[model samples]
Target: MSKRIQVTFTKEQWSMIEKFRGILGESDAELIRNIVLIWLSEKSIITTKIKKEMDDENGNRN
Candidate 1:
């Protein structure tokens, strides 16, 4: 089950959304959902990289 939500985008964001629609030819909801999933995956990768760097620094500090 899914719920409907509303978003108000700035002009710049609206333009970008239109561009995305042109390339994807998907419904706005589908595009947003896919984008969020991809964004979360990228965030996870960056978080892992940062944790590795912190671990390396801590290992060197001792």
Candidate 2:
């Protein structure tokens, strides 16, 4: 199963995406999907690191 999301962008933001899409040869949806996936992956890594650091500070090393 999959989920759907709706996002809104300013005209300038969209124009930048359109220019980048032309260079990458991706549709708007495809570009947004890739961007979201990459962001989520990076966010997960950062969150994990922060949690580990907090655990270490609390002397909960594992």
The prediction achieving the highest lDDT against the true structure is 2
The C-alpha TM-scores of every prediction are 0.56, 0.51
Residue range 1-62, candidate 2, lDDT tens digits:
57778899999998877876855458777788777766776778547787789799999999
lDDT of model 2, residue 2: 75
User: Which pairs, if any, clash in model 1?
Assistant: none
| Model 2: pairs clashing at backbone N, Cα or C within 3 Å | none
- In angstroms, the error of model 2 at 17 is 1.3
Displacement of the residue 5 alpha carbon in candidate 1, Å: 1.4
Instruction: Score candidate 2 by lDDT.
Output: 0.78
